[model samples]
Target: MSAEIKQAKCIAVLGTGSDVGKSVIATALCRIFSDRGYKVAPYKAQNMSNNSGVTPEGLEMGRAQIVQAEAARIAPHVDMNPVLLKPVTQIGSQVVLLGKVHKDLSAAQYHREKEKLWDTACGALDRLRAPNDVVVLEGAGSCAEVNLMARDIVNLKMAAYAKAPVILTADIDRGGVFAQIVGTLACLNKAEQDLIAGFVINRFRGDIALFKEGVEWIKKKTGKPVFGVLPWINHHIPNEDSVVIERPEAKTDPVKTPTVLVVRTPHISNFTDFDALFQVGGLAVDFVEHPIDLSAYKAIILPGSKSTRSDLFWLVKTGWASKIQAYVKNGGHVLGICGGYQMLGTKVRDPEGLEGPPGDTDGLGLLLLETVLKAPKTTTISRFEWDGIPGLGYEIHMGRTAGADRIALGKKSNDGLLRVKERNQQACTEFDGAVANSGRVMGTYMHGFFDSVPILKKWLSLLGLNELEPPEFCGPQGRDRQYDTLARHFEKYVDVAAIVKVTNID
Candidate 1:
């Protein structure tokens, strides 16, 4: 038989360390390539994360890949995330199959499954490249980990399989950018090192002119192009930190004399959920570190938390539970979402101790319901509405609530429990049998609840906050436009054309 050859033009984006802006840069590159009219796709072979998203096909994958695909203007594929590990316990994770939790396995067991995942990852890349000009693959953590080099699906193996060029990015802001780049290359095997085409120094704050010597030194040592020395700009981009968005530039408007005391629990997920209320017309918002007098704030918002049981335990330990109950008794508004929703119930059953489980435990006794942590989390995007209020948003969680069915406030969700359903139904109209109680407290499992600008404005107007206005921050083009703006900013210093030429793609 004649030898078969695959011509899949791809590139691997590797970072010196975690949170070094690899995701942002990858997204930016996707936008840049897509803007040039290329059929481009983004891929990540494996991801270990708790923040996840539901794809169009009612499956789940790392939320990062979803954001990247959006930047690429393509629908998310399970192949992008061939192997996903969502932490179910401290030492174990739920292995996801194409975006749905397939099995619960420990770290050891999952590592053993990497070889199988390589096939899946390679398949995804092939499919993506079939109709595309390029596939931008993002690597996980540091590619320099010698021990992990063998099992690595992201950098070395992915580069070899896709036969793609590589760009190693080092965070100058983290210091020792030189050492990171040089050390990484030094640690890699001959073949791995050969794959790297060049290096880029990201998140460079202060004067670039002053860093000329440093850049030159790196170029001389590595014998590669210094693609760019990007400066830090306060871009109000939606962050990858699902737990929190960068606190809005420390508002100077008198702190708004927060009328609501929002408790920011450790391990808080979906903190961005309340950005609307913070940006609400007249309502003042302040975060309380340790439980303080709740009598001042008009409402208490319990945002989503990653470790609900652990956070609830913290609330109990810090006496916030009693204080919250007292505030509610005094007619204060209390709200919860997702894990927070689970906390407002009667009891939380974690019989498997998947979430620090020894047994079931009682809740704050606010709502007459019970939550059970079960296999296969409920992750979905749907439109839900209260009997009298409008709703729009997505849902992500691992617990199911029971009891108080009649007392539930909204309509049953047309969507599945943990995946995005078809768009035949409007957003925020499917309530999943949960609705707003016209009493002292209200709760639901919805994430991104305030994304609907009009709905949020209406909700805030009902609370007598009429002065708040949503920022028309981006142009009508949404994130793509903003990404281009960022790209243009990078282009000022980066060899934008050279990067494309090096990759030999659009």
Candidate 2:
């Protein structure tokens, strides 16, 4: 290390378990520090998530880092999230090294390359630290996994490397708050224990005052401070993990409300695509795993998938395909995004065995479209318009679709659903997506389709749900509001001043 060169004071937010509000806490801290006039950056050495996003530089990174960057009021960069592991199968994941596709590897295969990944992660962290006043580092899953601790690049190992103060965040809402904290500490050595400056009890429900003794006990037992007990808040903040969608019943009942059924495919990817729709009042969004009566729902959304072919097979096996086809026949609207969009065609060909074995699978044949799964995944920030109603979104797909415009259905809105004006910040007149069967069936390669208020409103009008719609922003401004809300929530409950002091940053 150079004498004059200084690295940013890093704060490591490690979790007791996955989805323990680590990402949200890190995001809140990012906004809090940034608001205090510090140049704050969020870093995650590696993130295993199907929920990923494209950066302004046209690079792919975990969406969690993107959310934290937005909270910090900075443009998201690839360095913020250097390594992303997107799960394609139960045992295999498509490794994305520094914002580019690397290779698909199984669990054992991935661990073998951990050494190289660790070095890259460290280099990226050093770069991020060099220019920032403070960097908020987030950990993946439980930090005290004894078996995998040696190869852990994003948790305790990374925290120790940066010499950062770790805030061990535990979820109280899941119960066993004491066991969660104490058991985690029992697994770590004294040196690792010293790195943990304090704790944050996340998702604490009911009266926080009642938990004062609980906090005191944690401090007494561990000899470390309990910084705060974060309240259980149900906010519009988007989740970066697929775990949120695991319980399909979390949202309102599809049968009772004017609901939208999102077919929960086994390999569902980018599940956050429908968060905007979930916010609309008087409307419910339900992820139904099994086939159901589609007569009550206004629309059906087939979301993006990691294994499109596999999920397609599941759709058929689970009887969802027949139900969807019947729904479409009964004048139901079906909109597919990304991999889902690829499945709405007449046939899908994978000659090079990219998606699976080199073969052909018959699509739903809802449109005059055929697709070929190819290499070099399309990941770009896109600007487009739906019938002149402009919108902004991104694309991440591995298939090329051939929608024949010559063969059109009479008296139906056929062909491209979006007229693209630009892609990857470059100007080009291009049409994307396909629509057929009287505008009831539409498919687009673009994600974040509902983020644009105008486009959302237009769709609502088409579905006759415009009158029941609620007001909520979905882009940068909307996210900023949520960030501010989160910061405020933390400030109200947590000891913000003490956290700053722990960082020791001037």
Best-fitting candidate, scored by TM-score? 2
Off by over 4 Å in 1: 1-7, 242-267, 270-299, 305-307, 350-359, 374-376, 386-392, 405-430, 433-440, 462-464, 473-478
Off by over 4 Å in 2: 1-3, 249-255, 404-415
The 10-residue segment with the lowest total lDDT in model 1:
415-424
In angstroms, the error of model 2 at 340 is: 0.9
Prediction RMSDs, each to the true structure: 4.5, 2.9
Candidate 1 C-alpha lDDT tens digits along 1-506: 99765455888888777777777778888888888888778888888776666676657787778777887889887877877876656778777867776777887887888878778778777877877788888988888888888888877788888888888888888788889999999998888889898887888888889999998998899888888888886554455453233342222233345465567776566565665555444566666657676666666778787678888888899898999888888777787878888888888877677676458777787877777776567666565544345454666777577574522442233432222222324332233423335455767787766666655665555545567665443211345556677767777877878888888874
lDDT of every model, 2 decimals = 0.71, 0.88
